[model samples]
Target: MTDLVVPAVINLDVPGPVISRHLYGHFAEHLGRCVYGGLYVGEDSDLPNAGGIRLDVVEALRALDVPNLRWPGGCFADEYHWMDGVGPRDRRPVMVNTHWGGVEESNHFGTHEFMALCELLGAEPYISGNVGSGTVREMSDWVEYLTRDGDSPMVRLRRANGREEPWRVKFWGLGNEAWGCGGHMRAEQYAAEARRFGTYCRDHGGNRLYRVAAGANGDDYAWTETLMKQLGDLGCAHRPAPFMQALSFHHYTVPGSWEDKGDATVFDTDDHYRTMVAAARVDELLTGHSNVMDCYDPGRNVGLVLDEWGTWWNVEPGTNPGFLYQQNTLRDALVAALHFDVFHRHADRLVMANIAQTVNVLQAVILTDPDTGALVLTPTYHVFEMNKGHQDAASLRVDLPAGLPSREVGRASLTTVSLSASRRDGRVLVSLSNLDAAEAVDVELDLRGGAVADVRARVLTAGRLQDHNTPAAPDVVAPRPHEVSATGSGLRVPLPAHSFVTVEGRLA
Candidate 1:
């Protein structure tokens, strides 16, 4: 039997930084069906679409209150040329997506189409510039084309293409994965390249560009230290800096080695346990990277952007291996909940995080069937929808008792319960997850600095660890009302085994 932990206390009077709503952001790459079949069905398709984008997927994303979306590539962003994608679709050039699946890509969904989708979803567009295979002139001109309000060659080109009013794009990434697929450059080499490319990415009108530098991969502290040192030297010398606002890091939770990532839906108890342990490592990664940044940036000027993160597993059987299509299980939902708690605790230094490949890809929230026009909301989707209250809310410090009892999985051990709390509009919201796969634990909630008037809760759980939503049965794992009662001192709720729960209450 798993030990029942002591009550977790939340001090509402003490508030931390406001959690940036951008932290709940999503990513839509140009890979697989993420763009063509999942999000865009074309203007001539029989499926209901608004300007080539599927209406159902748009409505589902809107419900999550998605704050921002990163676009165009993981590796695709590096090889992509902006000019080939702009003009009339019929006249535009066609290219193969060399980095992802080697599939042919029509220049139909270019800058204009992406901006239109952002407008429809009411999300801020974050465009990743091509620094690996693109010239400085190309990147600079692309920014000028989208943001320049004045009369210029690029502005004329935009008018010729179609859009008259310039769409505002604030966030700009200098490159994606400069250390690997993005040119395989050394840390110092990439630093100089970033400065060169970022120099001409000028601000246009009201859009002040926030340039994000490509950062370390996983626990590569050497990479983090090298870039920080080089940038700091340039800043101290009074040289023009690269409008650098944030540094990005990519980390995915893989239960095993990259070559043999465990199956998404065929996992047993041990596989499930190991996955949770791996997801919990995000806290360590953030702390190690933040410490390195502090050495060069004592004031914490540069924010940490976890731009790509989620579980990566073997592709579903018979699916195109390069397409990276995998089913999201209950385990994926817990991983998301764990990440949310970690992000909230470090909201001061970490500003934004986007789950990798938002649709029809790794750990996707929404999956669709092209032939039947059927849509399935994965378990991970419910977790995001339930935890939407934490966006931009004031973080409340949570106090968990000692001996929380770490569970062992393979060679690693992790705490059984992960938690985060926040207060907003006289309401306190607490999110909790029980990592144990077999034993349900009773958690006591002690509220300080306030009295609870009423309480309500929602939980996501299933009969089996591998249970997931399929196109035929979409409601297998979804949010359901959970039992909550107000104790004399606070509230008490039972956290089911391998479950994620969110409890909200009015303050008295």
Candidate 2:
């Protein structure tokens, strides 16, 4: 028997308040079948829908307890014009989605459709403004059109468009990427441009805006440093010159070749370890970016919004590659858990995080078939559903020592068993994942101050390392509840290799 002794007790209370709910937010770009056949099919379709939004899909997302949904685009966000999506569907302009597949966008679903979808799912709407190919006045006008109520032209337009009320949108993205498709502007240039664009946005009564600036790409420390240095404190920067509340970051887990991003389902052991290492980079990026923010604002008021994240790979066979469509599997589930673990640990600084696309796109939670009118949930969807309890909870750090063995693949490998604990409503919930692809992990939970009775647990795993869920077999990878015990020293749980687990302990 291998002697795996309990490491030092992880005293998470040292820093205090580790988990934040906005970190659980999601994204929905108008790409591929994601918007067309995936989420919105119009009431005319054979499938049951409410206000043109898929009912089954809405119910599924509601079940997952999605906190927020970001709309328009990744690059598409920068090109979208709010006015084009409003008014009579027949009268709305028909434009080509140049950034995604060059498909025709009939403007069937616009601002009202998206906001209404958020209303149905009981999730907040995060609007991404056009910055790359839009003017300052255009973006500011969008804010007024959706938020302003009394006598503004935007409000009048909303009344003319058949929706007489305002959306009261709070979370607003200044732009997306900016370094890449968002304009390819230098850091200093984008900083100045951000200040210019953000200046005109108005804050309507009833809804306080949380303006998010487009942040750096993965591992781009210089980008974060430049923005923080140029813009100053973001969270507290309500001075109107450059009103900013959060900074945004985008990272996708991709293998060496962007063309051949390994395989979505069939992969060897090396690929398993490589995925973990790629997913784990999010933690380092967060840490490095936060340190840069610390240099600018030592008070730590500004927030880091991981607005776009998830696994990116070659499209599933027969799907549009540019659309970023891929199958979800147990491997994707582990990636989701790893990100949640990272977010939970840095909850205080990481205000909001959204998985790349919700449906029919990169790392989607739900997938649909237009011909068959079928709907299915993916393994990543199960991971999100199981971790809903972590929303808006205080993070309590668990003890994890270094020297934990990791698998290395081209300088990337799995290291330690990452865990994030939180306390909310008389319950302490811990979300953990073992990055190990081979060995089972022995975890000891030290719930000294908190009550530790009747620990209910849910886990997502599979028989094979490369196990995944396909349209043919959607339920293959899902969460199953089990009972876990608490001991005198702590709670001892054996985590299987390459698994995602969520444990809930009742507090007295």
Candidate 3:
């Protein structure tokens, strides 16, 4: 029994800055086919590619309107050197990825290639700097090579490599997980290091750099406090200067055990409830981290970037665990929508977030079969596509009337339903989710002073909780279009249990 009611008209007039669709950002690392075969295939393959990147995948991401992409990492960003991946591909050096799949990383997909891929997808590129195993100059020079204009050493190198125009990359990360894969440094130490490395990142014309400093992992409040203090100190007359515009946080929902991580495609009601509970922590993490930041910067100049997030589970049997590739299920779709709603509600501080990986990796949107030349769209992909109407729009704080508890059976618990409303291009989109395993939600959406018509919905659900798509069965969990009508009381819809629905209405 889950119910939500509203007593007053909610004013959504204060549209925040269009949520950086980058918060809906995707990751691409040099692990497995994620680089070599998944995204970049070297221009010689017959896999329907453009300049070595998969055409179908690019088309899919473009349709979803993915705004930005994070490159060369998770853990790989810490050890990557920008110079090794530039210029001639064959002449480039190959380094062994110490953390992911322990596979050899060819310098084939370097800065130029990444920027090219971004052009194909029409998305912004957010390069993660190597602060863990790299020097201050390396970080600076990499920025110059990507953004600097003519006459600079890095710019000359860019021209020599066939790219005369500087790739206008705006978002950059100083480090990833400084406490773990990014070199085990204390918050204070990483904060100081971040100021130094970020100082030299030039803000080339039209490329306003959003330098992200290394931040906390999960609910680590001290890390945020310590880093904020250091940043404040550097900005004052006492130090080199604060160059960071944002701070990053990484959280993954790993049920059962962190090491074992369970499975990507197999799980029961208990596992589902526990996963939602764990996923709900993102809101807490963002709220707590924002509170700490407010203490340091009350005016809210610094933004919180949830850069690395998604579900992490054990690898499939016979699959390389470090590759981080797994099947995406309806469960993952709910997790994606849940996180998206949370980020939107906290849009003031939670500026950007990148899902773990884009392809052939954790929570990937597109999965390709090298053997069959087939591509499968994961359930997570449809959620992003359906929710595209919310990108870069103002959010309305929902006043959900007192509702029944979602459902609790043993250790399993559900939130019943969660809501987020946004307006884009004259359409009001209300995203509703029935998180319960067995109860469908009868919802009444009150639009207050506004009227809506030409209503419709795109429903994402399946017969089974663990249902997913395969190369052989690509349309398993696809969106089903349905007609809807707005009532005088509000919009009424029967949200199927364990399903996600996005109701769209043309403004009247």
Q: Cα deviation in Å at residue 302, candidate 3?
A: 0.4
Clash-forming residue pairs, model 1: none
Please write out the lDDT profile of model 1 over residues 211-316, one tens digit for every residue: 9888889999998887777556533333324557788899999988889999999878888888988999999999999888777776677788999999999998
User: To one decimal, what is the Cα RMSD in angstroms of model 3 from the true structure?
Assistant: 2.6
Off by over 4 Å in 2: 1-15, 233-242, 401-405, 410-413
lDDT of each: 0.88, 0.81, 0.81
Q: Choose the strongest candidate by TM-score.
A: 1
From the highest lDDT down, the ranking of the candidates is 1, 3, 2
RMSD of 1: 1.9
TM-score of each candidate? 0.97, 0.95, 0.95
lDDT of 2 by residue, 333-439 (tens): 88888889888878768888999889989889998976787888888899888888888877776765544555557855567477777777777777777777777
The CA root-mean-square deviation of candidate 2, after full C-alpha superposition on the true structure, stands at 2.4
Residue-by-residue lDDT tens digits, candidate 3, 1-508: 2464322234444454466566788888777668877888778988788777878888988998889899888778999998998878899998998898678888888888889899998899989999999999998899888887868888888889898787788889998899888999988888888888888777876778889988888899999988788666432233313498888888988866876788887788888888888887788888999998887777678888988899888777777777777889999999998888888888877888998888988888888887887888899999999998888877766776565346664564556577788777777888877787776666777676567778888888999889999977888899998544456766676677789999887777
Q: After superposition on all CA atoms, what RMSD does each candidate show versus the true structure?
A: 1.9, 2.4, 2.6
TM-score of candidate 2 relative to the true fold? 0.95
